[model samples]
Target chain A: MSARELPLLFIRHAVAEDSHVLGDEARALTPEGRAAFRHHARKLARLTPLRGIITSPLVRAVQTAELLAEAFGVSGVEVHPALLPQRGAHKRIVDLGRERGAGWALVGHNPSLERAAIRALEHELPDKLRKGAALALHPLKNGGFTLAWWATPGKPVKRPGDLR
Target chain B: MSARELPLLFIRHAVAEDSHVLGDEARALTPEGRAAFRHHARKLARLTPLRGIITSPLVRAVQTAELLAEAFGVSGVEVHPALLPQRGAHKRIVDLGRERGAGWALVGHNPSLERAAIRALEHELPDKLRKGAALALHPLKNGGFTLAWWATPGKPVKRPGDLR
Candidate 1:
């Protein structure tokens, strides 16, 4: 696919503490979460490089986006309020990704990010978008998107053979 | 996912010669095709281990299935007439996969394999199933399957970090 036709990557933030004394938004990525996503980001960069990351302002989401940005070698991370956990934020998140064009990763929470993906593909995913996992949605020329690929953390990542 | 809930992988045959004077069914994988799919099969095995491979009786499809079976370490390659490149073969291909349960890869020609995936997910894919690529369909509890992940040949296959 051409650069313009690249899929929009929806990334759910990594694991976090069960509760935050301050609030949910203030909760940050646990050490394990940060380490896990740092690994996943590199694997993801191979499949599709990123231009930049658009992320929820929440602490955990921002942390996740930072790891992704580092792996993709992109410097900027645009924090969007729409990615904050809320009802119907999926529509705006998709709109933002479309506006930003291809090669953009959206980092956010579960239900909303997953909902956006399900809405775009018009199919219910058998597995939940796990922590530190990403789903790619390829844009169709006639409008709408198709589920392209998914990358989940903790899978083996060794090359089978010399493809080149 | 459980062993039973594992996705059914749909694999399009690797590159083949333009035509075989003998017949379409007689056409086999090119040397390059065999090498390329050998590499892809190993990468795929890391994601989902295959118990067995079911393929179209067509020569190219059977060859592709052999490479996959080797990598997955499965002994049997079941040749099924249902995977033939005929109109409406998609339904039968899916039924066979469902009957066989999970961890099975279906090797076949395009259009039919692609159609089977589209029918299962109920969505049109943005891109055609490229040669030497695999699309996974995760089974749901209620009924039907969901698009899980995709693996394409010729991409870089390095882990970004020490994920373990």
Candidate 2:
């Protein structure tokens, strides 16, 4: 695939224990979430090769990133502060992806990940990225990006090879 | 699923003979295109139940819609002028879907279909809708819609059941 076809995978952390059960930042993925996302990540890896994973420092996001690292066979996950569930972290995430020249899976939270995709495509997207959902953004020659596809837990994987 | 979850599936007609081979309006799907799209439609039907198919009057589009009608087990196809590959047809298409309520699959040509989706979501989307690609727009309670998913020929099918 061409460099332009390389994608920035925006992934939302998987299901976690209720915030009331633990402090919000310290919450981690439930056992089921880990297993489900591990399977989903493997399916995703079959579709597109990931160079590495960038994730939030939060436990849930970090755990999600680690699963992706395992699935994609990347050595380690890079924790970034910008991925904190903030309002405007989308810009920094996109910049980080561009700086790395794409093919990176970004493990983060909702709203921000959704916003990053919308901003990149300049169009409205699925309002919510369910826990453990991954949205692919393919770079354009003009510095813009387009929605490549979206994969969520339990959804049948669409193979990109059919397009060839 | 709630009524709001019903989707308006925007499907681009499968590949057709080059416009030069025949008049643009009369162009038909090549044998390969027809066979490929038939398989794609069957996979899509397994994902979402389509109430019916609305198609462009153009031959390629009608053929594509017919396959959807077959896969979906919808009685017939509705050919509409608004899907004629013209500028600003997106509005009419969305109106038709709303008028009939959601759960309809729309088969048409690109640019207009792509624009219709962008207009509905109010965000940039994939710049192109490859032949036989179906984009699902799930309605929101606010009378708007969110992208559910996108399916293209040759991609492994993502099962919505997994989301449950």
Candidate 3:
């Protein structure tokens, strides 16, 4: 990690079944989604070791967090209701990170997480959050976040120069 | 493609030899870069057929563009001097796309391409352009561009519903 940079990993859950069948918040990862997310977890483990993971209490997010914790040998993921599909929850995650003085992986839903990205990094994304996609943000000395790199599930881990 | 969207695929060049040995614009892709780019080209071929590819005159960009053209069976890539490391070049690529009324793949360098992404999509990515990362931008009906998707050289091609 660079001296002036603080890294934050924001991940969206992998694919889930139709929301109509199960309630929106209760949906779980599909078999393929699970398999792909495991790949993401492995890729992530190769990249950086997470000091902490804060995730939504929602089923899918928790599931994603669990896989990450298992992959990185973290104690466990901490569930935060603030990570639920709501506005400004990103702030809470950031607050948690600042309090811990360490990096964190935040797993949550779309639009809101994107919003949190915009608020934290002050940039817009081209589309909605893709299932199993992650954005790595690094804090700037100017008090804003800069996009460090991004990855998608089912993708292989990249080499040093492969990431910006 | 959506009626309201004009797709733009922005690609960075593959790995290159250090500038110390060759002139910056003349540096060629490394063997590893060529192999990785072939994979990316195949991935792009599977995604969508490009109406046109406009690339920087820089050796690396041209090399990357040639690989894309070969993979997609396009006749050839057009050289765009505007794509050379400079300010506001992304706009030129967008202008060309608007003029053609079709999707175009722009091959160029970083910071410049990343700036173009910011100018065209109004989004901030986490880091500098990776050696062969591509961002898909779709122009919205309301004006401005949205990132439809993104891919890296080593990452796998995603299936529908794989991204939530």
Tens digit of per-residue lDDT, candidate 2, span B1-164:
55556678999998877762225754556667867887898899888787767777555676577567657766545556677777778888777656755788888888888888888888887545788998888876676777788888988643344323
In terms of lDDT, model 3 sits at 0.67
Off by more than 4 A, model 3 = A1-164, B1-6, B20-22, B126-128, B157-164
Question: Per-residue lDDT of A59-121 in model 1, one digit per residue for the tens?
Answer: 567557656755776645555666878989988777776677577889998789988887877
CA lDDT, candidate 3, residue A74: 63
- Model 3, residue A133: distance off in Å is 49
**Highest lDDT against the true fold, candidate:** 1
Q: Write model 1 residue lDDT over B100-163, tens digit each, in one string.
A: 7678888888788888888887888746789988988887765688777777788643221311
Q: Write the per-residue lDDT of candidate 3 for residues A1-164, one digit (tens) a residue.
A: 64345467888877866652325654556556766777788887877667777766555665576567657766534555556776666676556544543367888888677777767766676445678887777766555666767777655433225653
lDDT of each: 0.74, 0.73, 0.67
Interface RMSD of each: 24.8, 24.6, 22.7
- Model 1 ranges with Cα > 4 A deviation: A1-164, B156-164
Off by over 4 Å in 2: A20-22, A158-164, B1-164
Ranked by TM-score from best down, the candidates are: 1, 2, 3
TM-score (C-alpha) between model 3 and the true structure: 0.45
